[model samples]
Target: MRTTLYGQFVAGTKTDEVKQIVDKFKQYNVKVILDYSMESDISTSITASNNVHKSSFNTELDESNTFKIYHPDERIFNTNMFNYIKNSNTSRELCGQSSFIAMKITALVRPLVLQKLNQFLESRITDHNLFDTIDSLLTTKNDFTHSLTPNELGEISNLLLRINRIIQTVKKNEGRIFIDAEQSYFQTAINKIVIHLQRLYNRNNLLVYNTYQCYKK
Candidate 1:
């Protein structure tokens, strides 16, 4: 499957469930560098009732984000969902096919903790509402989020704590994790977090990998 990091890492999807995929690939007998389709967003609701949100985030892209009002078709990639997956399951623990069975982190965690963490991240550090950021473009809007100014430092503490937790978990597990490249708007902040995480977990081992995306003239 052409999975994103969100799917494979965050959602804890079953590699066993994709036995057909594994079998097909095994035919070549080469190797696999798998990516996941689920992200922290997958943590939202996996039950039958949550299919609406699942379908949208998992398969479809829409013009819903504040930035999309200007950069329509832009993908926000749902931080809450990504955070949900990262915080939910254990990289070290899980049982299934041996691909992950012969694995490392070998731990397990609930999805709720991740949901709470991302909620904290979404609110306190990354709390600005959609309308607030794009108030000028909005025709009819109440000024609830406007009064709150950005708290640069406070905005990062939630992320800082979360990143620390991720590094600790990954190191404790001996697993490799990757961070997808992001748009330039978030490059500075994301890079800072990655650097901090690398120092803590990957000083000796290459546990964390980052994608490099560039703009061409």
Candidate 2:
């Protein structure tokens, strides 16, 4: 399976191997879209919470518990962003112009954070139109931190800075970025953030593209 499924899909784990594969693709006039695959979804945390509740009667912290939660700190997320940017720069170096970078907001910011933001927006914005809600989110003067608590405001700010760093790398490399979409529950927040990036960086040229699932309503 590793030689077939993983080998057919993944480029390589090492820089030299990946460069060789990327160059081979370039020989066929194909551009690379490098994606950082490490991510944690909100549903994982929810399931862990359920398991923890189920084990509440134990009254002791079980070191052998298999269901660990995913609450990554800002430092861990920043490290991930740094590695992502480094890999993206390497891809640009190997593939040159027209190469693309694919990134997920959930990878940069905590999925739970996105879930909270989505819940807040859904509660505040009553409109059924998705675009309308996004526009409302973008136009807000408070930078979408109006009703958020201090810690949440800090998280949002850090999340924006991380995204900006990624986009800035794409702009510097003269490459484009594809903001990968998430599940329906997280899509609204992702859309709002990506549109904000488009407004900022895509004024002169199309550099940021937001991906949407066609099968989704």
Candidate 3:
């Protein structure tokens, strides 16, 4: 079913297939914005209340029982993005122009982590220390602290590292990346990460672009 739909709308399923599609597009002076269409689902059981408890801030990333079990695909997002980068690079060389890739943050980070972070940001605390506070809470585990468990922290760290790698790859290939807007629940975290990437890569021109879904408005 998906194959039929992909054939109708999507470029292709594999790298070589997509390259062929891109080649055909180049014949018409068209460019491609490669995208990995994986989106995270909101788990009914996972909530901000379940992860956060108290106001204590010190935390660390390690293996622990308190961390939420992550979806298996979370580990595979980076691999998919890596493949996309490689394909985009090939497409660029084939067409002799800039290539673009679209990303959905939920594909890289778990929705639960984003929910907890959003709750933390919305809380009556200092906004300037947001990342620091999140970092401190993510690095340590204590009964007195209300923050992410060691395993969750590790997962978040891995997600951030993967995002950084994607940005680095795009920069290296002289390509551009655009982040897709997701549900409202995850937008804040998405925006934060996108802004960070934009600051780093969008120095002279817009190497990173973030989409805002107007239909939601």
Candidate 4:
């Protein structure tokens, strides 16, 4: 049953299986866009401090249906993505062309952190010192009253490191990556991450592309 369901939509669940599928597509001159469909496990949560005002924004989610405030294990997601890129690179080497990998930023960073960061970015979008503000947030070890907690800041830094690793790996292997867009609520944060990556990787040409889901608008 599981095989029948996912087979229709996904390439494959295993690395070897997916690689075989990509190889088959190569025979038809069709390139593959590999995506790890684990982003649905990502969820939003409300801290105890925010519970007082949760009613105002409908921030409370069903506890049983959601993971913890932040997804406790990001390494699993990172490893999966890294392996996908490595495998895709190997396939590309055999095919002598670029293979695309799509990433959803929500899978790397918690939704709550993104929500807070997005709020900050939205309020300061037009500020002259916007990049400076981002730099400060990324480097600051202490939590300001209006800023993220120390733990959340650390997580964000770790996320950036992991993302940079993926970007560097793709660049080294002569491949490209696409950042997949999600709902409008999260688009600002997603765009910020993609822009950061573009500035780093899209130097000579457009190696990284951000998907614009026009249907949402």
Against the true structure, whose lDDT is highest? 2
Tell me the tens digit of each residue's lDDT in model 1 across 1-217: 4455654433335635444455565678733333433333223323422433422332222334222111111132224323434432332333112122111110111122223323433444544343232212122223223422122122233334434455555555555666654434344334444555566666786877665667635
Quote model 1's TM-score: 0.42
Which residue ranges in model 1 land beyond 4 Å of their true spot? 1-15, 26-152
- The residue-by-residue lDDT of candidate 3 on 1-217, one tens digit each, is 6746657678776667887988798789888887767667577325533564434433432243332334443435555556656655765665454678887777766677777655654562455554443344454455213756554556676676667777777777778888898888777667766776777778887788988879864
Between prediction 2 and prediction 4, the one with superior TM-score is 2
TM for candidate 4 is: 0.74
| Candidate 2 lDDT, 30-132, residue by residue in tens | 7778887767788765664454333333222113342122233555577778887987798788777876888888777667768878876667565545445
What are the per-model C-alpha RMSD values against the true structure?
14.2, 7.6, 6.5, 7.5
lDDT score, candidate 4, position 153: 68
Task: Give the better candidate number (1 or 2) by TM-score.
Answer: 2
In model 3, which runs have C-alpha deviations exceeding 4 angstroms?
Answer: 2-4, 44-74, 124-145
Worst 10 residues of 2 by lDDT: 60-69
Q: What are the lDDT scores of the predictions, listed in order?
A: 0.37, 0.72, 0.65, 0.64
The whole-model C-alpha lDDT of candidate 4 against the native structure comes to 0.64
Q: What does candidate 4's lDDT look like per residue over 108-138, in tens digits?
A: 7766777777776676677645554345657
lDDT of 1 at 39: 30
- Candidate 2's error at 198, in angstroms? 0.1
